[model samples]
Structures are given as C-alpha cells and as structure tokens.
Target: MAWLSQYQAIVYGNGANGPILQGGRSVTEQAIISSETRQAPQGKMSALALSALGIVFGDIGTSPLYTFKTVLGTAEMPSDPATVLGALSLVLWTLFVITTVKYVSFAMRVDNDGEGGILALMALLGVKKHHRPSIVAVGLFGAALIYGDGAITPAISVLSALEGVNMATPALQPYVVPAAVVILLALFAIQSRGTAEIGHFFGPIMLVWFVAMAVMGVAGIARHPMVFAALSPSYGLSYLFSHGMTGFLVLGAVFLCVTGAEALYADMGHFGSRPIKLAWFGIVFPSLILNYAGQAALVLEGAPTDGNIFFRLCPEPLLLPLIGLATIATIIASQSIITGAFSMTRQAIQLGWLPRLYIKQTSSEGYGQIYVGVVNWLLMIVTVGLTIVFGKSDNLAAAYGIAVSATMLMTSALLFIAMREIWGWSVWAAGFVAGCFLVVDSAFFLANLTKIAEGGYVPLVLALLIYGVMWIWHRGAAAVSQRMREALIPVDDFMKRTQAAGIPRVPGTAVFLTRAERDIPPVMVWHVKHNRALHEHLFVLRVEIRSVPWVFGEQRLTIEEVAPNFWRAEAHFGFMERPHIPELLAASKSLGCTVDLADVTYYVGHETVIHRDDGMGMPAWQEKFFAVMERNAVHVSDFFSLPNDQVVEIGRQIAI
Candidate 1:
C-alpha cells in the first residue's frame, strides 16, 4: 500500500490520469524508482555483484577457453610473436571498449522502466504496432538473433571445454564429441528443476574459476614477460596496417572475445546495473585480461602451434583436472544463455510480440526463474545437432559472432534513439556517441561476413525465420484488434439500447472479458443477439498489464457502477504478475461488487483467422502463418487462470 502511494506521487501526480485508480501509480515509474533505491546499501550490492559473476559473466567469462586459440588459428594470422601479440592487443581492447565502455557504461543506462535488453530498449523508445513499426521490426530481429547466439554459445562453449580432454590423452579424443553431447543433454534436462536450487554454488565456483585464471595467467606471464607489450594500442594498430586485408579478416576471430557482451545488457534486469558493473570491473574483467595475456605469453614462449594454447598452458599432470574445471565453467556459461533465452521469451509474451507459451515459474521468490518447455527442448535439439554437424569448436566458432555483431549494431541504433528521446541529449551529441559504437559494431559484422560459407549462415537464417514469425504475429494481432474495434459498440449506448429492448434478464452473473475497457465486448453482443437473454448482474472486465514487476492487492482493481445491476471493473497487473480471474473477482468485492465464484460464468472471444488477398494489409502467406500461430497460441482462458468449466467461448471469423 505504501508502495502504491509512492507510485501515485510519481506516476499520476502530474495529472496524467487522476484518482479513478487501480494501482495508485504507473508500473513503469515504480520499477525505475525501486531499481534506484535498491542500489543504496553496500552489503546487498556486493552480494548481487558476486551473484552476477556467475550468471552475467558466464558467457564472457568462459571466452578465454577458446578465444585466443581461435584468433591465433585464423587463416590470416601466422603463428609468430608479433601476430600473436597483435591479436592479444585486439582482444584486450575489444573487451575493454565493447564490454566495459559500451555496455557497462552506456547501453545499460537505456533501460525500459527498470528492465534492459534489445526489446526493453525498444519499449523505452516507445515502439508500437503503429508508431515506428520499422524500429519494432529491428528490435524483434535483434531479439531473434540472440536465440541464434543462444544455440551456438552452448554448443561451442561445451565442445571447446570438452576438447581439452583430447589434450590430456590421445586415447580420449574419440570420446570428446560424445562426452559433450551427454553434458549438453544433461544440462537441458535439469533446466526444468530451475536454477535456484544449484544457483548458490555457481557464484563460488565461478569465483574459483576466475582466481585460477589469474594464477595460471600470472604463471604463464612469468615465463614470457614480453607478452605485456600487447597492452599498448600501437601493437594492434601496427598489425592492422602491416598485414592489410589479412589483419582485417583476423578481426572476425578477435570479435569472439566480446561475443557475450549483449548478455551483460540482456541480464541487467536480473542483476541491477551497479552489481553487473561491479562484477565486470572487480573480477571478470581482470581475470579475462590476465588469462588472454597468459595465452599469448604461452604462444610467444614456443608452445606448440597446433591451436590448443589454453590446455598447453597447464602442466601435464593438471591437464585432466583443468579439463574438468573448464567443462563445469562452460556448462555454467551455457546455462546463462539458456536462462537468458527463457527470460527474453517471457518479455516478448508480456509485450505482445509473441503469443503466450506455457511459462512455468520455477521459483516462488525470484520472478526471473522461469521455464518454457518449447524453448528448452528446441534449444537442446539445435545445440546437439550443431555439435554433431560442426563436430568441433573451431568450426562452430565461425557461426558465432555474426548474430552477436548484428545484435550489437541494432542496440547501438536503439541507444542513439534513446539518447535523444529518453535521456534528452541533443541529436549531435547522441549521434556522436552512437557513431562510435556503430563503427565498432559494423566492423565486427562485416568482418564476420566472410564466415558465411563456412557456417555463419546458420544464425542469420534462424534470425530471419524468427523475425518473420514475430512480424506476422504483430501485424496479425493488430489487424484483429482493428477489426474488433470496427465492430465494437460503445458500452453506454449498448447498455441503453439493451435496456429499452426489454430483454429478459437471467438469474446468474455473467462476466465479459473485453479488450477495451469503455467498449462493449463483441462476444457479449453476439451472446445477447443469439441467446436472447441477459444476466441480472453483469460485469465487463478488462485486464491491464502494467510496466512494473508487481502491484499491491488493494490497488489491483477499480470498479464503477455503469447502470442498474451492471458494473465495469479494470484489473491491473504488473508485467511480471500472473492474472487469476476468480481471485480478482473476490478482490472486487471490497469495491462494492457482490459476486459468488461458483455462480459466475465468463465469456471470451475466439477468432478464426481467414486469409484474404484483397489488400486487407497482410500478404496471403503471412496471413496463413499468422493463422497457424493463432491456432497454436495459449488460450485466453488458460493465460488468465480462469477455470475451464466456468468459461464459455464465443467464436468469430476475422479476415486479414
């Protein structure tokens, strides 16, 4: 209730929408303010930062396992001290500029309410079905590309770690792929049980992993101290000019060091910006730099030129134990991306970009712990298939950076818009900042283009397919909403007309679920037109999803009497909250509505989509696609938590 008061002061105090209130304020303002307030205490901040090391840094943190090797093995680069040092310089600067400066300092600032991600950034820019549809498409495509990254990240990360086994024993080389497949399958299998159970161990384990990286890196540096020269930007610049096109191509591999940079922004909602930043600056960044430097040090110290520099840095006796640790770390890395996919899918459903899936909240305390069976299993199949097809981390690496680069490019564009609109920066100022990121992102994207024939086409094709689905669903939903609006009758006029017609009033209460709060539901009209009967007590209810994470019960529903024995109620819920019809009706009793759960009948509209070629806006193919998606979408009754037995569906056909 006190939170609602704060919400009212911040959201509605500007006379935006006055006191006829449900949830005293807007959810967006509450989320933003609370996110700020949450960062005040030092102890809590440290704990969150430590926790973030496991979840937020897993993808990037595990990069040292393969990044240096991949870069050194790139066809353009010869195995020499100068080339290796140049690649190391690029890796260091890429991590610092892209991960630390771009994401931690800039992109994270452009959150939607308190949430961050490409989609959330689009929401912050006020992208809608009608307004800036192009921007919406871009944002959706960026999100889709992340799923592609999600599939490849686990495959490559686990495979690369498992490959360390081959270094330990030549006899175990045949078992690497099989072993990786097993580990990946087991990881996906346990996803249903939720991460909360094992999450506590993740932080401590990652802490040890980082400490080990620092120690190994220091040991390697002791053998060849000259590798520290790679810290200078001049080495990278000199290599680029000296090698010309060959150096440029090597950037594709160099880009791998920052492939997981988007995860920092995507997972910001789970861990606040401060904590993520702290984790990056405090532990993750230093360990990554040291480990990468160490790998370069080993290469310069005349280690074998076979591209297994990571394991080669270890003493022969510790190699197997190191492989075990690396495998566990990589598994943790895979879990981060899989969990990120689940979170992004939930966000898409809440924002109406995608249809509802059966989302299971796996934890009672953390709203972020969710499981989607479709996403989980689909990722498993694709990841395993990729491992089988690519057969090695080196081959999977080619498919990796393209999606990440494209996503970063989109984020840069969106961040430019946010700077002007949300942060009130001048166009010149915004463009300058965004221009720098655009240059970096575009270079990486173009560099990775040469990899298409090798394996990079995978994520691009996957992104486009997903983009088509989201685009069709968005357009189709708009068309349906438009048709419904065209057929809608004003509630006041409908009430007056029905009363004058002298229709017989039935005994039980009938609740009509509506899209618009002030308009009569089309389903209610159809029910009255055919059945020729009206309930004695009628309620028109609309459920509104707010931009916040939670809403207090006292401010959850607003009820008003529209006519004799008729009422209108608006039930408000945060995007993170689930809606339950019976519970809402019970809460409405406090607002002077007398309702019995057992005697209530709920009315809902079900549309059958028909494809038309007469330029009703959508193409015939897209209309068909939309129809298929609509047919499979989770039913409104199920989404709203209404009992199946108490619900009556009214069917209608709409052509688009």
Candidate 2:
C-alpha cells in the first residue's frame, strides 16, 4: 500500500514501457513526480492497470500465437488428454512462476533508485566493466545478449502474426514474408517519428486483443471442462517425469510463454510495480492462462490445427479479424524490445561500456520515444535477415528463447547479490530464494541450448559480437581515462608556475570539461601552454553519472571556488538522464556561482589512440579496435548539447 501511494498520480498513463521513462526521461512523470499528493482518484489503479496492458504485457500477451504450436511440435506426441494437459500445465505454471513470481513479485523489489534493468541492476551492485569480476562480467554479458533478443523478437513476433494470413487465405502464404518485411520496415521507419501520437491507441487496442484472446480461450475451454485439470502442478510434473528427455526438451518451447517476462521488471520504473502487478493478476495473468488453456483444449478435442492452433480457436467468420488484431499486437510487442534496446544503449554509453552513438530524441512526449540510428538500423537488418532466412514462425522459434534464458539466469545471480548487499538477507535465505529461480532458469537455458544447431546460434553469435565490442570499449576507455589522469597537473603547482611565468588573462568564462575533480586537466595545460593565456573566469566542470536513476534539485550540482574566479563544479547526472552542460551551468548560479550564458566558451579533448609496441597496454589488435571505435564515436559537443560555435577541441594522442 505504501508503494501504491508513491504512484497515486500516474493517472491516464499509456506511455511505452522501458528504462527510458524513468525519473529523468519521462514527461508524463515529470508533470506528476514532483508533487506529493497522496489522494488519488478512485479509478487511478484501474486506469494505470489499463494503460499497462499495452506497454507491459504486449509481448507475453501474444505468446499464445506461437508458444502452444511450438510446444506441441517439440512434444512430438499425441494430442491425448494426458499430453495436452501436461503441456498446458507446463505453460500455465511457467507463466505463474517465471513471469509473475520471479519478475513482477521478486525482481521488481530490487530496483535501483526505482529504475530496473540488467544495467541498472549492475549499477546497483557497483559492478563496473573495468573491474571484470566474474559476476560483473556475467551481468554485462547478459545485458549484451539482450541486443540479440532485440533483433530476434521483432522478426519472430511479426512473422508469427503474419503466418495467420495463411489460415485465412491459403494462397497468400507466398507473400507473408514480403508483407512482414514491409510492416517491419514501416515500424523502424516510423520510430524516428515517435510513438507519442499513436501510443494512446496502444492501450485500447491491446485491451481488445486480450479480451479476444480470453474469449477465444473460454470458448474452447467450454468444449471440455476437464481442461481445467491442467491447471494443477501434478499434470506438468507427471508429464515431465513420465516423458523424461522429451518433456525436458519441451521446456524450451514452454519457456517461450514467459519470453517477455523481463519487460515486467524493466518497465517497472515507467509504471510503478503496483499497476503492473494489478495488470498482471487482474487482466494479463488470467487472459494468458485462458488463451493457453484454450489452445490446449482445442488440440485435445481432436480439432485439426489449420496451419496454426491459435487461429483455429476462432470461428471461420472471425478468423481474418483475429489475424489482423494479432498483426497489430505483434507489432506493439516488437516495438517494446526495439525501444528497450535503445534504452539499454543510452545506459551503456553513460556507464562507459559503450561508445557514444548518435542518439535522436524523436519526441518531446517522453524520452522513451528516442531513436538510436546505429542500434535501430542494425536491429532492422538482423531482424529482416532472420525473418527471410527462417521464413516461418516455427523456424524462428528455434532461434529464439536462448538469449532471454541466459539473461534471466544472469538476473537471478545478480538478485542473489542484491539480497545480501542491499536487503541484508542472510546467505542461506538469499541462496534458497535465488536457487529456485536458478534451477528453473537453468533448466530453460539448458533446454534452449538444444536449439543452437536448429538456428539458435543466430542470436548467440550476435550477443557474442556485442559483448566483444563492449569488453574492448570499456577496458579501452578506462585505460585512456587512467592515462589522462596520470598526465594531469596538480592545480596548485600548475597555477603557481603559470603565475610565475606571467600568463596573459583573457576576460571571459572558459569552461573546460574534464574528468578531474581537483586538478588541472591536460587540455587546460595544453591551452595555457600553447595559447599563452588564461581566462579571467575559468570553470573546471566534471560531469558525473551516478548509479541511481535520478539526481535532482540541490543534489545535482556541487560547486566550490578552488581559487579566486576559478571554480570547480561537478554536475551529477543519473545514467537515465540526458545531460546538457549549458543548462546545468546556467542552473549553477542558484548554488552561489555566477555564469554568463552568452559569453561562454567550452573546451574538450579529442584523443587519438596509438598502440604501445612494448605491450604495456592492451594487445595491438585491441588498440586498433579501440582506435576505430574512437574514430566513429559521436563528438563531445553534440553529446553534451554544447554550442558548436563556442566549443573548442584540444587534440592529444594517447599511446595505450
């Protein structure tokens, strides 16, 4: 109830779910987050719950579209009551245990400053890429694997929906891939236009989608009341033990039912845990159960699957309409993961695990409505290629599941740490709780592993490529930063030497962006040494991105006068924040510092990396790899929103 009280005013929230809508990134929350009004409208919970249907459950809600079909194929057995009930039971409990129990109930409680994600969790545990602890490396690798999910989710989701076209007009099967291509292309193209304008419809559309799913499920369940028997745990366990390896392998397909469970926690900061929980239990949970149960019931009645069992649940008259709705729902599901990749990327950039890519703010509605050109296009290419290569949802299913399974396993490992470090849980208690998740997650992961030769290697290869780049960038950047620190001059010594040499003073504020907190930056040393002058007012600004989700009000900027007319200020931003140096500097006047917006010059470093042949640094190839990343990284001026006309780049070559 107290957690419920923190979100009393997130009324009418239909914003997309991801890390991007946390404290600093959301416009809707910004309008209401500052206020402490505890009195909520009577309908607030239900309204927030309704809005959550679109954003929170889009992917998992559509699981029935392909999950049951894939599960039946993997089972390779009869549609007898025993087999059907066993598979149904597995699907039902997997949703309950993994999606509801693991993510919504447990993981959401471990949020960092109310932001939740693999990266945010790493930040919470103080896991840095440079440290390279086993657990830390696992977490980073897990985060990198999600990029593979980003590529595959859209391909599978959209392909599954379009496959329903065959159920209606069998002749149109040839055009399914091309139609999916066009739809996918349109989806990525429209990402630059922002989801704000059409996002409101997402809630109502998903509401209809869920209701249709539940109705279709209930209709089939009515044909056989014994289908409810599958709701018991015994059915699933009996099937697992009786069938042995066959049932074990089926867990791979069953895992698909909880595929998007990560969104429940990742989007927790967007809409609070209360509304997401409400949506799950009140609507999403029941709907998914009914739909999955419905599909199983249809199979049990000896009803032939007309290409797809999910489409078969509908009457002939409604089949086409259902297919159309599935198409839309799948697209929404695709959007969730694509935006999730964008959100993860920004976090990686701020935390130094990634090179700065060109980030475009596609909408003023919310920062969640952002586009990363590199991430978007790469995802597009991978997704389309997967779609074309696989040519059907069934084949794509083999390529899916592994990445998310590994991610969940890594999450369980991190949650164990959070319990001990943050919650102060006893090792025994933490291990017991985390052990259950690990067992389930590991079983799913191992099951999914069998899919590698069946095309699962696609995502694994993508993930490995991403992790390689991340590893190099993080270590490389840290090395460069360390060397730069080593080369910095102590402010007192540098100032005394400059004063003795009678350096000329120019009259304007020169803000030098540096990582140093209390020393003269190398760029500044170069500026004074070569230019032979110093600004009358010099501000050494260090922008720090904290582990939390937000740094607000008085907590954001710390300013001190290290010398007369020479101030050293540290502007703190959360990983979720978009930092604008000028705006923050303008706000510095509030903290007893005078700053002129019009007459300011910004100075930054442009380092060119060169390999050390003696091998004190990284290997020669790694040095070259870092050099290529640096060459393509976004300029510091654009990244910080600095004015181009007033900014200067001081070039320095670092041998690493």
Which number leads on TM-score? 2
Q: How do the residues 1-656 of candidate 1 rate in per-residue lDDT, one tens digit apiece?
A: 45422322221100011111222323334344555444446656676676777787788888888888888888354568789889999999999889999999999887765567898787667654347877887899999999999999999999999888777777888888999999999999998777766776677789988988988998899999989999998888788779877888889999999998998887676556887888888999999988899888887888875847888878889888888898899998999888788877776777677877777756443445567788899999999999999999999999989999999999999999889988899999999999999998998899999899999999999899888777778789989888788888886798788879877888889999988757788889999998888898888999876554456656688999877778889987655456777777876787898755558999999999997657756888888889998999888988887778989999988888
Total residue pair clashes for candidate 2? 0
Superposed Cα RMSD, model 1? 5.9
Give, for candidate 1, the lowest lDDT window spanning 10 residues.
Answer: 11-20
Q: Using lDDT as the measure, which candidate wins?
A: 2
List the global CA lDDT of all models.
0.80, 0.82
lDDT of 2 by residue, 514-613 (tens): 8775698888998997899999888899988787777776787899988888889998877766777877788778888865556899999999999876
Relative to the true structure, candidate 2 reaches a TM of: 0.94
- What lDDT score is found at residue 476 in candidate 2? 95
Q: TM-score of every model?
A: 0.91, 0.94
Tell me which residue pairs clash in candidate 1: none
